[model samples]
Target: MFFTRKKDIVGIDIGSSSIKLIQLKSQKGTYQLQNVGLVPLPAEAIVDNTLMDSASVVEGVKTLIDSLKITAKEAACSISGNSVIIRKISLPVMPTEELEEQIHWEAEQYIPFDINDVNIDFQIIAPDDIDSSKMNVLLVASKKDIINDYLAVFTEAGLKLTVVDVDSFAVQNAFELNYNPDPDEVIALVNIGASVMNMNIVKDGISLFTRDVQLGGSLYNEEIQKHFGVNNEEAERIKISESAADSDRLKDILARANDTLAIEMRRSLDFYNSTAGEGKIGKVYLSGGGAKSAMLPETVSQKLGIPAEILNPFSKVRFDEKEFDPDYLKEIGPLVTVAMGLATRRLGDK
Candidate 1:
């Protein structure tokens, strides 16, 4: 028998406001940070997951790759927002080969997009010892046009796209690696990016419910800009750090924005709990640039009546304190959660 090499691949998370680049080396099944970078992009570069400014995105990615001097030619990236759909459904017990042949036909009933215009993939969930006539499966679909856009962007940036995972699954992978939770416990991984919030409810290591809400950190920035009449940069700083004169009003604006997010979370969680039959979520872990808001977790907790905390992806990864500033890594910890998850993936992994 012969063994194959597991080629190294960089993780690139292209967000609407910034591009995150992370490189990791695995030693004995543990991850070691080799290089990390964060590059800001124009707001118009990717408006709502649509690659509007491909040139700017390509330039940003190229600059990061050049600055970090990443020699890896393969990469794993992720996509989110309106164009992607994830659903968990039950199907009649079938063999793996048969399931593979008919997945597209099964996906058509649940997917809203034209069957011919989307790419589909699925994973079969194993059942307990108790015999059952049906099996649970997770169906993921993404528009072909969006896939083409990413392919073009990466081809121009001089990298091979090896794996395409969803933002929600990436967060889950990171969480599992960092915090080995109880199998019986429930977890709600809330990843709030610049323009979209992905809420994934996991039970026994299975995704039971997932939803993408069009609300995120941008809400706070918009409110701050409108109230103070400041530019986007200043608004972002004020929202994150409260480094301004109108402390009282700034707090109010942030609370107002958080209200929108909190209400939405409450509604969605309630709906899932009532319908999915999954037990109450043990806790909610927030990760994203939006999770950096000073009072976001608290606001969400108070509104939802469930504990919420910021997810620190570096909790279990190895890195030198001298090579990376601990304070800086801590500050950007939440923002890199998705990239960390992507970096952990090896070729041909599920």
Candidate 2:
């Protein structure tokens, strides 16, 4: 069944609050959107990117796929949260097999979990210049239990999983597809998810550092709902649509939430700088649902003293007349960055 056939692959992002799916195809260097659907998760189904109720997620995924009429069986998915760890390390040059064996010991020094409890994966970045006998490799690990739970949900939805990429890498891939930053300069890719904010610093197209913060869009919604004594739906609407309007009360609430986001981002960037001593962040690229907020970019730019801009993955992709919706895409485009990156996965690579 896994032959040379190029099957359409769907990118499914099951976030803390909602499940979003998108299918796309490349046409003459342009990506044309094929299908898109969104479904809200049940209350407390998923918390902090971990699925507590597989039935809720399975039903959500199944319903979204059916509603969108997506025929693709192979899907590209992602995993995030504190359980996943990625690091670039230097190792003495050796055969791939021996290198793999040695990396496990090295991982033990960094990873906090038991060796058997994690799924270990690695990629050799390049040979070290200072030491010809050494190689720089990237190591990635995720809790096996977490991945199994994620896979079980998809299996229940009748989807054939093709790639189980980490969320930070997906955000990086999405950023790469949209922008080609200067190789020598460092660019920050900050993904503001519902409950977690993942910040990745890339230089020369290589991920130099990555950090996840415990703050995101949900903070703003919760703050507004509490301050205004409104329902969740009303709070979200005010956060996105009314925050920019000429309403004094809404503006005050938005300012407080933006302040919180700024402080969280600052903490992450500070950690990134401390860990990545030599590499400095040149610019910040904002992605995820929270990046769609009108005043967010300016607020972050001011707070971090770095140029910040919302990512538009479709900027380079050509739109098919029947497939593209300009108005909707403009609003929901930032949320598609991760899904777009997952959709662009090409089997095997370095």
Candidate 3:
């Protein structure tokens, strides 16, 4: 049983284009969406997932809370992009004390950064039944500066940071919570953000392949800006606009975006397939703002032989309709997978 742990907290996803917040109250295996809101980022609040201008992020977060009427003090957030690294390694099956000692020596082969500059943590997966002598471990590392910057935003907004997670794990958390796919199945979770696309492949609930691509929704806007000679703001408006006047413009932008994303998707899958050994990816789950593009799933399906579909983090979870707009929630559901996963983090789980 995956995602057995439950908790009451807010899931805050800070992306390059916007900040999305969600708070859910669990009751009898169902989730109640107590609050949901989004705050648009300033022109330079985040660049490539790094907090470039703290003041802008803080201001936007503060305004989002006020406008959304969110009273929850504790929230969960996640980080992605260049500063994060994930690796899978094997270690002898041993007691916790011995395992810690072995991890340091093991780090020499995995971590590229110096031990002093990075914060390291690991979660033990199931013991290797075939080998019986080894255990699977998932290692995660993020630069201290990146984590401190995120904490600073919460501090300025007067929100408590109850948990911090990387985007790949967060997406995995959301998947476990909602889908609960078979642990033995190799699954791919792809998060397409404004400026970065992240793909994480997991087998038996442990991460095996991880990578980040430098193409995302922003490229669509840039293409629109160049093709139509429109300002950034105007290009963004047309990208998601429902106005009849912009229908043709939307189709054109998405066509080009799909083509570009398909190229990157092929490269990622090829890299994973070449190194995955016996672990073959069975399906692709798409999330993030760019994933909402109607053509993205189909495009990816054509480029990669695996079945592709949009991932809704709340599909299986029930939420109170009185406190939330079901339609609105569904509209933005794909983008909240990371935030929802982070918020579902229970105390003492790590």
User: How far off is residue 183 in model 2, in Å?
Assistant: 1.0
Error of 3 at 21 (Å): 0.6
**Top-down TM-score ranking:** 1, 2, 3
Off by over 4 Å in 1: 1-5, 128-131
lDDT of all the models against the reference?
A: 0.87, 0.80, 0.79
Q: What CA root-mean-square deviation does each model show from the true structure?
A: 2.8, 2.8, 3.2
* Alpha-carbon deviation at 5 in model 2, angstroms: 8.2
lDDT of 1: 0.87
- What is candidate 1's lDDT per residue for 1-350, written digit by digit as tens? 00024677898999999999889998887889999998999978998899999999999989999999999988888998888988877888899889989999999999998999998888887653245888888889999899889888988999988878899999998898899878878899999999999999988778888899999999989888888999999998887778779789988888888888888988888998888665788889999999898788999999998899999899988999999998999999999999998888777776
Ranking by lDDT: 1, 2, 3
Output the lDDT of residue 100, model 3: 66
Error of 1 at 60 (Å): 1.0
Off by over 4 Å in 3: 1-7, 128-131, 242-253
Q: By TM-score, who's the top model here?
A: 1
Show pairs that collide, candidate 2: none
In candidate 1 the C-alpha lDDT for residue 58 amounts to 91
Task: Give the 10-residue window scoring lowest on summed lDDT in candidate 3.
Answer: 1-10
